[model samples]
Target: MKLSSSAYLRAAVSLCSLLAWTAGAHAESVERAPDAPNAAAPDAAETAEVSGDIIVTAQRRDEKLQSVPIAISALTSDTLSGRGVVTLSSISQVAPSLNVKSYPASGDTLSLNMRGQGIADSGQITKDGGVGLYIDGFYIARPQGVLFDVGDPERVEVLRGPQGTLYGRNTTGGAINIITKKPSGEFGGRVSATYGSRDFVRGTASIDLPAIGNIAVRGTIAYTDKPGWVKNQGGNNRYHDFGQLAGRVAARWTPSADVTVDYAYARGRVTTTPAYFVNPSFVGSLPGYVATRDQTWTALPLPESESNFVDHQLTGQFDVSDFLTIRSLSAYRGSTSHQFVNYSVALTAPTFPVGLTGQEDYRSKQYSQEFQLIGEIGDRFSYTGGLFYARETGRHDKLQDQFLIPFNRHVISTRWVEAKSTSYAAYLQGTITPPVLDDRMKLTLGARYTSDKRSATRNSLVNGNPVEVNARNSQSFENFSPAATLAMQWTPNILTYVKVSKGYKAGGSSEAAPVFANTFNPEKITSYEAGLKSQFFDNAVTFNVTAFHNVFNDLQIDFVTDPANPAVVSTINAGKAHVNGFEVDLTIKPSSNFSVRAAYSYLDPKVKQVLAPAGTIFDRLRNPASPFSVGDDVTRYFTLPFAPTNALSVSGDWTFLQFGENELSFHANYSYEDAVYTIATAGPAVRGRDLHASEPLERVDLRLTWATQLINDRRARLSFFANNVFDNRAAQFTIAGGSPLTGYVRQAAPYSEPRVLGIEANIEF
Candidate 1:
């Protein structure tokens, strides 16, 4: 159905008004001093008072999110808890531009795609990451880090667009900054217990120590578990795999009024639950697809696997004087995972092309360190300059067995590969609050020089025996990136800004024989953006809107193994592309009893030019006068995967007085995704017939929380929250052309833990 322009305009206005009212209405009542003890913690009374300003380092300095020129979204602890955003997937429901794909084999390993750009695997041993994810200003080079649980974080700042200069390492898209809660001196904390259906149980505790001279400490721990939704069809308690244990410990020390030290350690592990392709032959093509087969089609029995992750962080800051502060950070992380699958390749039938059996083992180790000084050159200017360094090493091994290989069925073929990479960079950024214009205008500038080195080796092995290999390569490059931004506060409550920035992603080593060499070039993006932020109606509402255009060059394109080669897949440069989009966020609190938050993102992302080999699949899809000639027209054939063109989200909460101090909050969401190709393939020939297709889907979510606080102090409270209240089954993606032909599929990892009727209670003595 085509929506009229007028209807679109009306929808936009309605969404904006709803968001502005929720966040602005009660903001005036909430007043938090910067030096207040444990001020970042959740307190219903405080939240009901007023919406406080969100301080962020988007420009490499502490400034109000509304006043900063960059496009960003920061979720405070209250917002996080209220929305039940415990995992990245849940967080995506609030941030429309972000999407996280989970593999059943490795729940601990997340594949994050922001603005439709990101690595497809956690095991990928590449030096560059799509979206730079950070915790306390330290970079996380692998997607595995995004899988961690929220461990008493003060806030999470999601900066949209490239941050190549201020944030080191890989930030081709942007960055996610997680700021953990610091230790407090008031000496108090809370313990909470939660119980839900499916044997779900969770416990969390935190405590702050009394100030010792000028220093104090706080520690937090959390644990949770629940039974899975998938049943083991074969019995013997083998098929289902669910969420596992996750934990963290953090501490802070402030020995002097001007200095502070902080540290934390975290780990998470989950049993992998792999999904199988449902053959259309047995399941039919009906809207409600279901399998009719009685036995698992893969060659091997169901496989159980696991993915684990660990992280350590240390930070220190010292005030050299009244106007200068120095800071440093050190972090180390490691991850390991394994997966085994009996893949099929039939589009409509449960049939394994070569008889089905595949196993892959992956591991990675990473370390990073950074230092910076944040202070003002004078009262008119403030600056933050830093240096960063990181190293990562990983190994991947895969074994395949095709039982239907005529007489040689028992002989299994395998590929083993190892890769090591390291990266280092130094950067500087400054925000100049010029005396002119009476501090109404600011200029932000930053730059970074980064170097990446990589080496890899691949060999064929059988039964732990080495076979033959053709080639190996090692390469390195040093790149420089810079960015600038200018902003002006038209009034105390309104701000406008413009920015020009560059983004870079490093190359990697790929094992393809003929050595069908796979070497990726550094991808870069030059982006231009403009935005507006306003707070009106007595601060009862906040609204922000931004538009951006990005020019991407030498974009890295992942390669798929050429079926004929079986041992090699070559990477290629995608030439150039353009991405233009608009994002808006609103928060409104029309009255103390009602509030709402809404966000929407629309992207017109397309490939401007594609440099591909003649006749190489993609050419057929986008026929042109000359295959090598550059063009401006980008059709559906060139669209990127997981990059939905339009996204809309709405969430609201209502408090009723008749409920006797009880609060019932409900959240609902609707999303739309355009069609996209799953892979590059000769659709008909490769699949025996047409197989690949785009996944267009929509899902609704509803959550309700009922709670009451006991003890006039409100230190003790109880509430119940449920997610996926409707249990809608929607497909997020499908791995087309996988052997079993039944249209190799990967369902939208079932919204397990359905209708979680749970109760949570917290108490403090």
Candidate 2:
């Protein structure tokens, strides 16, 4: 399928008209701001505190959320703790805009999709993260960091829509900003301990030193562990144990009334995690040569089969004069994972066993330094600008069991691939707001340019003998993304905005097949969005709404030459696609004793144009040599993976003053995905059919807690939490043509955690 330039331009014009109208509507109304009952305003607290926007640097400045016209949701420390969210994957139920999927065979990597845009890596080097992740303003390019547990955080800011101008590289869907607690002058400390099912144990502690007029220090640490869930064929799933440890220290110094400085550092690591399946468990089809259940799932042999990750972050802030301030942030992240898997490949019933194992090791190191100068030079005009520089190096090595299978006496096949890459980027963004027009409107524009370089070398050897005759290749490319936003504040509590932006993913060499040796080109997206936020009924309710459309070009896709044999796969530019959606969040507090928050999202995603081999028939076949044989007629189709068309989440906490000020909270969420097809449509399908392309699912979670003062100012709480309370038989993953024993379709899933009961205690000193 092909789209002409004229048609593309007409669509762009329509998008622009929609944005303009939405912005105009927001400019006609005004509303009040939500009250922060926990902390006083910065001016009233005797400090230049952060704003109540919950999350910012949105629009490049510190402004009240009600005063900014962008759509954003924030989870503060208290919110995360109340919901039992410690990692990105766990937060999906609370944040309706994001979905995280697990990779069955690879324990070290997890795939993430947001607003219907994402790509799962298949031995490539194209840097394919659709949503950008920022830790205190530093970019994390690798997907490894997205799966780690970093413990309690100061706040998580989920900005919806394309943020290309401010955050460079592949922010086609949106961005997630994680902000850790910073040093403050207050002196105090808290420690908490918790225990639950699956041998779950967690501990967290934090301390803040009292300030002596000028300086203060803060420190934090946390730990967690969860036992295995899958049953092993040879034994219990003893190897599924996983845990994380993190620590951070920070300091803030004020030498004078006009200047201040802040610095901090943090680090963390993850222990062994279970990789229990060869493919999705519910896909209903089986590929030849795979196990029906977990076989190699057991405790590691001296921890050699465990996956681990480590990261260190540093940041600094300086008040460079009353009218201007400068801030800098930097970080280094690294991870390594190794796992041995089980597999079977023949499509025969009562699948036979094939001892299949694979190993992957990746090391990614990144450096990012950003400097920002913000100030108001005159009463009529205010401005902010920043410069960012980042450098990253990645090295990956993968080895699978197919290469070790013995073909002939004293003969073994080889399946080993390696990827190494280095990338650098520089970006700048600035926003201009005029003091005139009663400060009712602002115009912001920005752009970023990046250069990406990659090189890969693949070698196959059979029993000390070379098979592919030494294959080597390399490629590089450059990309530029630009953005613009128009916003207006009609009232203190209501604001509206419109934005247009472009998103980009780097290009790199593909290792699918030796023929053609194709190099995937850069994928780009143009997006338009309109959003509104307001507080009504005297701050009792806060509501936000957003609508957007995105057009993708030069979409990079992995094409398989032999659908029957997935080993012979390659990459190519697959034409175009589009994504349109709506999102809303509403929070209502009828009174001080009770409050409730709810969120929902609706998305319509489709493939506009997809190219493939002509007259391909994707279905089961038995013969190989004939032109119409099963192996030669493999087929391909365009479909979205892991994208739920509609999602709804509702939660709230109510407090009682009569019963020792007890607090009770409950939360639940449900997501519905329109079926998604797995890899190849025509071939040995997953689960005896094609992968679960169009399937609907439902999940529910509930938790209740009771808290009150015990003795010596100590606090005690009893809690009950149930995940997937109904034990719904929803599949967690789906894979095609993975194992011979499991058939072409395989499902290795993450069942919902069973019901759990726990007790918590916290002490203040």
The best candidate by TM-score is 1
Model 1: lDDT to the true structure: 0.63
lDDT of 1 by residue, 16-86 (tens): 34433432443344333446553323322233325566676655556667777888888777677666666
Task: Please write out the lDDT profile of model 2 over residues 438-513, one tens digit for every residue.
Answer: 8888777767766776666667765667877546667777778887788887887788899888877766655556
Each candidate: RMSD? 10.0, 12.5
Root mean square deviation (Cα) for candidate 1? 10.0
lDDT of 2: 0.58
Model 1 TM? 0.83
Q: Where's the lowest-lDDT run of ten residues in candidate 1?
A: 740-749
